[model samples]
Target: MNQGLIPSRYAKALFEYASEHDCDKLVFERMQALSEAFASEPSLVKAVRNPYVSRRDKIQLLTTASGSTEGDSAMTRFMELLADNNRLDMARDIALAYLKIYRREHNICLVTVTSAAPMAEAEEKRLKQLIQRHLGSATMEYNHLINPDLIGGFQVSIDNEKLDASVANELKQLRLKLLN
Candidate 1:
């Protein structure tokens, strides 16, 4: 199995199932939580990836780690399927793929705004509006981050595209020009 293909296929199947059942939002949220957990708890991910772990045990650990067992039938079934298929090791990648599907289906754009200082509410609002105008017809998930090293100004990253207006970047460009 190709490394990326397995998780992508699994994610797409889960997404389609959720969409058909009108539970895509719920599953998407669950996948996001799982992805975050995989990122923060490398040990947990390692345990899941371990070939010796039984399917039942992996399911138990995953459900317990998620802190929810109160009738998310879709998620439960999905996890069981992954365990059966020996695809539990690809949980993180599946979650990532699920998120991409969710965002695409819901017309959402995840954007990060990094600046030297915290942006005021109005500034944030204006920036979001500007982004919406440029991107067109999508809801933005605006993540505001502060980086003192930026010196001043801000940078906006929408998906893979970056708009760099940071002072540090400008200075680097200036330095490069001078060197040239």
Candidate 2:
């Protein structure tokens, strides 16, 4: 089976379980924290992925690393399933997939706004409103980033859609039009 397929399958199972228990949001948040912890501690990730390490050892390490958060039986069971299926290395992917499912269920959309410079509070608010209007979705989360290379204006991305209105892009378009 494909690597992605495996994680997605596990994620779907966990999502359903969480939904039934009405703990989907909690699980999603916990998984995200775990994923970030693992990413920041590459040594731990490497140890978990090492085939030389026994399953029991890996499980012990995971339990210790998870600390109080492992109190959730669902998460504990999910960890055991990962170890049993030898898919522990895909923990990050599984967490991400779970977050995606959770967001979809809550009708939350993540939007990224990249501008040439830091945006004013008013500008940010206006841009967020514009995005909400365009998406026609009440639940929108905005993440702002600054990229001076853009020269001016901004670019916004919500899911698979992108809206670009940077000065650099406009200049390129003008140059192309002149060439034609």
lDDT of each: 0.88, 0.83
Name the regions of candidate 2 deviating beyond 4 angstroms: 38-45, 53-70, 174-180
**Model 1: per-residue Cα lDDT over 1-180, one tens digit each:** 688998889999999999999989888888878887888888998799787988888998876665446688888888889887778888889989999989988998989999999989898899988998988988887788999999999999998899999999999999999999
Alpha-carbon deviation at 142 in model 2, angstroms: 2.0
| lDDT for model 1 | 0.88
How big is the positional error of residue 139 in model 1, measured in Å on the Cα after superposition? 1.5
Task: Report, for all candidates in order, the number of backbone clashes.
Answer: 0, 0
Best by TM-score: 1
Instruction: Kindly list the per-residue Cα lDDT of model 2 for residues 27-82, writing each as its tens digit.
Output: 87777777767878889888888999998888767655554264678778878898
CA RMSD of each candidate after superposition: 1.7, 2.8
